[model samples]
Target: MRALHVITGLGVGGAEQQLRLLLRHVPAQCDVVTLTNPGPVAAGLTADGVRVIHLGMRGNRDLGALPRLTRLIRTGGYDVVHTHLYRACLYGRIAARLAGVRAVVATEHSIGDTLLEGRPLTPGVRALYLAGERLGRATVAVSPAVAERLRRWGVPGRRIRTIPNGIDAPLFAHDEVARKEARMFYGLPEDAYVVGGVGRLAPGKRFDVLVRALAELPGDVRLLLVGDGPEQETLRRTARALGVADRVVLTGERPYLPDPGDDAPGVVALLSAMDVLASPSAEEAFGLAVVEALAAGLPVLYASCPAVEDLPPDAAPGALRVTGGAGAYARELLRLRAAGPGGREAPQAVRRYDIAYSARKLMDVYTAALAGSTLEVSSP
Candidate 1:
């Protein structure tokens, strides 16, 4: 079956990565369209032999290009149009409907106001989006938290389908030699305990808070930050001011996985090198990175927000979740680091999140979406 996948941009993020993974494994023919033109994700699509069209939208609600989008969808004759992210989901679904596609679907990777950190969207905009969200043949929630949030916003539970995000398990499974080699490449001290944080360098992600936590640790503990974003400079300054600049390694936007074997084993290796994974995201949809760390057999000290706490129990063990505030985070760091069981063996807690298994579950979602069956959101 022919399908059209629409997204905001090709920049690195969970939503973009999810599309990349879906493109690699979806059991159907697919094409991608980027409303904000091409970026890193475009290369992934091209590598997959999937056609990617760039519409070059100048700003939000740029209807000047709607006719072009409609023509392309009609000409492609796709049976399905699946959208990711807020802007694309809003406009792309309407465009797909206008093109008269048989099915339209959207995956809400994070809650609606993730940009606003769980706050309600402006009343008018919320109403408008609530109506737009219901336009789809099916709305997929990447996690239960996201689905429940949608329900609170007036979207019927009947229209929401929860699908937890999946990772390539083998990609995150532990590797000792590779972990050492990765640390050596970064000139990290062999005996020093490492703490790593991965994800976009944005305010909501709270990378500065991670730096603060790193400063609270002893000198032997170093912090490694993967990925890049608009707040890179601000975070760099924070590290410098916190007097941990020398101990911080910022590998801006490193490869997700150097070898396809683990999708992005470099990340896994970094996780293996850490005594603990610190995910201080104030808001997260599914905590994919936390799950990856668990799969790598590393314990996590993450934010205790509903999104992170609501993750399946199978993925949460020996996990020190902090819910209070900055002081709470510092206390947790001190507690975990003092009794640090630095990289040892892969924990048995991660088996349920195996990539192959999750991929199979996702395939079922694709099959159901294609067959027009409504999917139910499961309880966390």
Candidate 2:
């Protein structure tokens, strides 16, 4: 079936990268619409033969984007309209209905207990979310935890589908050659104990903890912050203040899937170069970065990870949930560094979150939407 995927922006992010990856296996014709900031991922989608349209949404209050998006959807002849992120969900669902599309689906990529897309979950935000939610047939939560959050926020159980975020497991598998190449590409010494953190360089991600933790460790220990955001300067400043500036490497942003022959290494290669991955973010819809790190056989330390927490302990043997601030991380880092570096085999969690399985599950959601049975969704 022909479908259109609407997202707030196409920057290098978990949800953005996941969308690009899932489409490789999704069994239908698909196009994309980015409300604003059609960055690298949009280019990646286009390179992969998917048509991409930028709506040029000026800001949240740009009402003109509404009519423009509606016209695009109306003329696209799409059988299903899938939206991602907060702003797109709010606007895309309304536009899909107005465009006469019956099958509308949204994926709640980030809806924390106290935040929705990094904004505070105020009464106004919740109210508007529920109101716009009524316009869609289903909301695909990235994990059971997020599904539960939506249900608690008054989204009916039948309208929420728990489809966890997935990854191309083998693509991230550890490789000795890749490890050497990646370390050289990033200018990281092979002997340095690299502590990697992958995600937006945002306050909520708590990357500062890793920097502060680095200050307490030896000079040979390095911190690698992946992805980019407004907090980039803040993180750099924190590292410099703590006297670990020279050892910190902010790789800007790396794509999960890179175009053929791209000079820069993709996330898979970068994962190979790392000794361990740490996610100190307390709020996570799904610990995608943690899973990817596990897929790379790198040990994972997370503050919160529904992807691992929802599963049994054995599912992700390398992942450990840590608490407290930089001191807590510093202790863990010292223990891990002392133990030395060696990647484990990809665990059961990696097999469970396979992208192909997720693709088929998503197809089921799309099939149900098209067949007018969205209300029959079952919990995962």
Clashes of each: 5, 0
Q: All models: lDDT?
A: 0.74, 0.90
lDDT of 2 by residue, 34-67 (tens): 9999999999999889999999999999999999
Q: Provide the clash count, candidate 2.
A: 0
- After TM-score superposition, the amount by which residue 73's alpha carbon in candidate 2 deviates from its true location, in angstroms, is 1.0
TM-scores, all models, native as reference: 0.89, 0.97
lDDT of 1: 0.74
- Per lDDT, the best of the predicted structures is 2
- List the pairs of residues colliding in candidate 1: 169-355, 171-262, 256-264, 257-264, 297-347
Where is model 2 more than 4 Å wrong at Cα?
257-262
Q: Looking at model 1, which ten-residue stretch has the lowest summed lDDT? A: 112-121
lDDT of 1 at 40: 68
Judged by TM-score, which candidate is best?
A: 2
